[model samples]
Target: MKRLVITLMLIFSSIIFSQSNYEILPIKQHLNDIYIIRMLEGENIGLYSIIDSKGNLLTQTDNILISVQKNHIYLVTKDYKEGLMTTDGKWIAKIGEYNFKEKYSNMYKEAENNSEKEFFIVYINEMPRHKYGYINYKGELQIPIIYDEAENFSEGLAAVKLNNKWGYIDTEGNVKIGFNFDEAYDFKNDLALVRIDDTSFYIDKNGQKKLMKSLFREGKEKIENLGYHIGSAFEGKLKIKEKTN
Candidate 1:
């Protein structure tokens, strides 16, 4: 019985050893030139390293590495900010420039595969004011950071806020729709919702008002039926004059 137990122990140790050492993982779908090697036993345990097709180490190490098709490598920095790195170990977009923590993946998901005009939304959260713009996969700033607020591209257009008013701009940074609404939303089914003077309605791609799906239908009905309260902090700041006999 003692001999059998010793043999079993030896087999278990060997199995663990085999599973922990430098193991080459499966090649990524589009990134056929690089392979991911995982080190499960040494000091770099739980980390991944990028290697060329010929087994040459490209990146020193990565906490997490994701292949965003078309040879773009996504990596998270030591400080938790995300950036794009080349397979040969070069930074496409410097770390900490944009806080793309959870937004990096979503950007590529919406991108058109291999489209040269593709742009991803980028923003800075530092002092002064937070501004938004667009950037290509190569980290080139296609649009200047001038907008107060911006949304992702939809139907080749994006809703942006300038001077406290919302409008739509094409991928080329040209104003496709004039800035006139107080609030604007993304386009879906060739229509978008916009609000002005506390009234909300849907508009088409041409900025023409469409008579469907009023945003404040319920609120308007209530106001028309029972009237509205004013002056009270919970109600609003507007004051109403009381009738005197």
Candidate 2:
């Protein structure tokens, strides 16, 4: 009887040991110092952890997807919600809070270029209502999810639509450009093309309209030179006639 009890205890110990032994797979390496560790085994299977090069655990998470972008880490939960965290395992923001998707366009490029200020667009999809907002790299909701549509930051400002009117907002969620245009485009060359009713015109960063006479002259010259009307004045490309010897 004593021998049987000892055998049962040994079997239980072996089972616990086997279950506790987890297989570590390196998924991503950041800054040559932090490693994104995916541990497979035991109760924390499918979970992720961060460790330094010397194997010191920095943080552990149950997020489904963990991605590194510059100094910040993006966390995606199993339920499709997204958030951000720091490399040292600090929760800049908790996961599974908001529905955020990566905007993979010029907006994303603009955000990538401005590494000093981290910002991301938050998208909310609901039946009969779709909204957008902005969140900083630290996972703080900088802009409330209330806009009908929102563009990525360009030239330190983002174009957003509210009640069918488009305007621009700064990084701090301040309205740099008032909501007055029927439509608006991203800023380029310190100016943005906006439409009021059917008339489209260019506006400077201060929301002042630029004189269209020079732009119209350039557009007409391009149309006559190229033999094709290029839609809008801003869409028109000037064709320089080469000087003949």
Candidate 3:
């Protein structure tokens, strides 16, 4: 009986040792059967590979892997060009001009769930002068690189800067809100906060004032919770006696 127990313990140890050899990465970045795996033991530890459901090697490439979307694989070539590939290792399309954001990291893992816009933001030229624009999933430029500053789309609108003024634009690049504000922010709950000259207030989708007594009271309560009065919270941008109709 003692011998049998010792033998069973040895077998269990062996099973654990073998199972610890590899690590299955995040599933959101992979298809149903395809997965990104990394070696956790032996000399090849830390090495990554693309494998099938049955652990069969699919294909190997030195290009930096970005993310998988639908049937296409996004990758960055050795020469810094961004492109796509098939699951069976065939080239789809390569674009050289725009450098994709997070080229070396895992990007777009949950992009499908977090965004409604099909376009992603990209920048051109160097810092302090990098013009911003949007691109489709197929590496096609949708919006021209013209904005001095840009933010991601929220509720079908993105806040962008032009001629040193901020405004909102739709996914089609049409100015939804006129460029007249000194600062702007993304929309949330059908309202966006904007500032003109020294006054800060909230606006609706049509660029109309949306500050009601309820919103003002809510802001005051939140500011007080943070140990700040509403007058100081807006830094003189909000008037103390501003009537809310």
Candidate 4:
């Protein structure tokens, strides 16, 4: 009986040692010729490391979860917050500073352009109230987290809501449109639809109301003409006409 117990202890010890041994697998290859490796072990199951084709470690991280997006590697923490990193494991932004959660479907979308810097929407959890802001790839706060709600960038601007009113803000966080509309939609083809008091009308980039050439007119005339009101904009056109019997 003593011999059997000692054998069982030895087998358990070997199993623990094997589980603790690190196993590496190549997960993604970046355009910069660096490879992102996923390391699995008893203690560090979700850890990531940067490596070369020859399996040489460039950098290792145990806290931040790595995701490959385009030419960049995004670092996400356990709390669902995100940051940007280079292929060589250098940080473009520190993890958890920005609250952007990467979507698997849109992960490989074109991010940056030569004309404008790439920006991401970040969410801040402030207990009873949650706010959103914008951050560039450099981790600079382009927009402060003062908005109660926000939409992604469209046509160089984004729709934000504050105090129950929707407005538009440029990439630099400047208010290009006043916060007077009850509802606003993203701009497309230099035009957007906004609603005030129950009437919906199209607006230019400069916030000037554009007369809809469609059957629907503007203001009271629009309501009287269509026997209903325009609801919202869709793909550069206002298609939310009310159902009139």
What TM-score against the true fold does each predicted structure earn?
0.61, 0.63, 0.58, 0.64
lDDT of 3 by residue, 62-146 (tens): 3444466655566664455675545444444444656544343454354454322356677777667878888765557778889
* Tens digits of per-residue lDDT for model 2, 32-95: 5566666676556777666666566655445566666555667665555676666555667666
Off by over 4 Å in 3: 1-28, 32-60, 64-95, 101-104, 107-117, 126-128, 213-245
Per-residue lDDT for 220 in model 1? 71
Q: Per-residue lDDT of 166-207 in model 1, one digit per residue for the tens?
A: 999998899989999999999988988888987888889899
RMSD of 3: 12.1
Query: Over all chains combined, what TM-score does candidate 1 have?
Result: 0.61
- Per-model C-alpha lDDT, please? 0.69, 0.70, 0.70, 0.68
lDDT of candidate model 1 versus the reference: 0.69
Clash pairs detected, candidate 1: none
- Quote the lDDT for 94 in model 2: 66
Candidate 1 stretches greater than 4 Å from native: 1-22, 26-30, 41-44, 65-73, 85-97, 101-117, 212-245
Q: What are the per-model C-alpha RMSD values against the true structure?
A: 10.9, 8.4, 12.1, 10.3
lDDT of 4 by residue, 112-192 (tens): 431333777778888787788887766678899989888888989999999899999999999999998999999989988
